[model samples]
Target: MNPVLHAAKLGVLRGWIEFKQMLKNPQEFGFNIIMTIVFLVVLYFQRNKTIEGNDMALAMFALPSLLGMLVVFGGFMGAATTLTFEREDGTLLRAKATPNGMVSYLISRIISVTTFSMVSVIMLLMPGLFLIKGLADTSWSGWLLLLLIFIIGILATLPWGAVVGSLVKSTASSFNLTMLPLGALTAISGIFYPITSLPDWLQVIGQIFPVYWLGLGMRAALLPETAVLAEIGESWRYFEMFGVLGIWTIAGFLIVPKILRRMARKESGSTMEKRKQEMMSRGY
Candidate 1:
């Protein structure tokens, strides 16, 4: 086999093993379970409540949207945080020392992160099917669309995580730059509420980010046709969702390799030691 192909295959195997390890790790499994429970609890409380101007259960409206939000969160923040910590721990430096290691390393990260994100989605979804109504009728096409949106969501957001991870000097800054801002934006992105209810400018602002488009895409996949009544323009807006996410996807692909290369070139034992000292000084 070609060296690159062999490396990629090994990377895939490594990622799967890491993913299994994550499942076995008490802390990791606990975190996922906690998040799943928190979301379910919130949705449970919303079960009887109806959205303004619509009788559909708010939980039903929010469940798939939350799944969508999870995609962007897991893809971007997960990647950024992972990269930042691993960089601090010299994982990237070690990868730089091996033949075709960078490629294998990146592939493993993409696989692990993507699969873990999907596992989270499933963790939420399995219980969600029992907790939320109106989802029971989702057809084969809906499932396909949901799968496609999940894939595109990863493609759209993960590379941006890599970019932010490369640019930020620390995980603290990574969270400040990526997760904090995203959490704020998600408030207006309509994961838990209707976008149409927001001010016109906020609606416009919300639409510009992947979080909103992702929620909209997931809702389109899981909700009934009548649910469109609550959306902007009263349609699925498939074209717009794909168009915006595609732009992000393309831009990230074009930008990340150059950034990663530059960041890799600057990696050295001294730099790694400096980061370790900084992290220790911060009591991390």
Candidate 2:
């Protein structure tokens, strides 16, 4: 097997272990499931009937965007939690002392979070599809497009999660900081409404990140072409979506590894010990 594959296999195993641990925590799992369902319900009901041609089935237009949002939330947040919590607990420090530890650890996290995000998509998504009405018209090609966008979207955002995981100093701080921007992004990214309905400035902001385009791409894949034009613009908007997301993915690849390296440099036994002591003193 290839070195990358071998390393990835180890990472997958590590991630699976962590994922199982997360599932065993009922409060967290319940919150995640409820959050996803609530959002799906809201988005589905709020869907524009005009876009679906007087049908509520038009909710398909929102699925891709919501999937993107949910995936990012789960994967990025899960990773952020893992890294910060591990750092606080000294696991990261211990791992760093092992040969190939850094590689194994990071890869494992990416795999694990990606898996969790994908599972969330299935659990939350399919029910919305069935409840929404006319979405049954989706061709195999449409499904293929959705799957492709999903995979690429996951890869594109995973790097940002790495950057976030590397940057946040602790679990509490990460939680407090993450919610606001992510929530704002959900609203502005056309996940619940048509991007064309947003202000020009907001549309510009949408273009600056992948979420908007990811939503647009999802709409393109699952909704009717005419419906998309009515909601966003022309069908050709997908090419633009492809272009914008592709650019960010490439840029993220360049920046994230450097950030990870710097973060790794800061991971020392003494620092971990000090953090643990601080947490212990604070009754954490």
Candidate 3:
């Protein structure tokens, strides 16, 4: 087998093992459960409420949007946290010492993060179907569109996550960097409400980010055509959604490699030991 292919295969296996181990870990499993429960509770409160000027239940309206947020949150935070923690623990240094190790590491992180995100989506979606209405009314085409948007959404967000992770110095810093901005974006992006309801300026800001576009694309895929009445311009704006997300996807692909390579180049035993000592000094 070609060396790169062999390394990729090993990475896939490693990722699968890590994912399984994560599922088995009580802390990680509980965290996923808690997140799902929180989502369900929010939907429960919105179950009887209907969107303004539309008969659609608020829960139903928010379902796909929540899925979009999950993609961004999962991919972004997952990558950021994993990379920061591993870098601190000298995982990157070890990989640097091995041939093609960076390639393998990158592939494994992608698989692990994507799998974790997808599982979170499924956990939320399954129960949400029973709790909410209208989601099950989609056609096969709608399902296919949802799948495509999901894949694109991951591609659009994951690389930026890597970029943020590479730039941050610690896990806490990574959380602060990703969560604060993401929380602000989620509010403006209308994950729980219609973006059309926000101020024009806020809507413009939201439109520039992947979270909003991802949610809009998911809404386009899952909601009925009449539901567009609640959207800005009363249209799905598929072209705009794809265009913005495509730009992000292109930029991320073009930029993440250089950043990762630079970060990798700086990883050495001395640096790792320094980081380790800092962690110990902080009692981490």
Give the alpha carbon lDDT tens digit for every residue of 66-108 in model 3: 9999999988889889999999888888887888898889999
TM-score computed on alpha carbons, candidate 3: 0.98
Angstrom error at residue 154, model 2: 1.2
Error of 2 at 268 (Å): 1.7
Query: After aligning candidate 1 to the native by TM-score, how far in Å is the CA of 124 from where it should be?
Result: 1.0
State, as a TM-score between 0 and 1, how close model 2 is to the true structure: 0.89
Model 2 C-alpha lDDT per residue in residues 1-284, reported as the tens digit of each score:
87666766787799898788777888867887897778777765766544433343446666666877776677557767777788777777766777667777887787778777777888877787777666667889888887877877776777776677778877887776666677888788777666677799997887787777667666667776656555554554766777877887788779888987787788887888787788788898
Q: Give the range where candidate 2 is weakest over 10 consecutive residues by summed lDDT.
A: 49-58
From the highest TM-score down, the ranking of the candidates is 3, 1, 2
Ranking by lDDT: 1, 3, 2
**Prediction RMSDs, each to the true structure:** 1.0, 2.6, 0.9
Clashes of each: 0, 0, 0
Score each candidate by Cα lDDT. Answer: 0.92, 0.73, 0.91
Per-model TM-score versus the true fold: 0.97, 0.89, 0.98
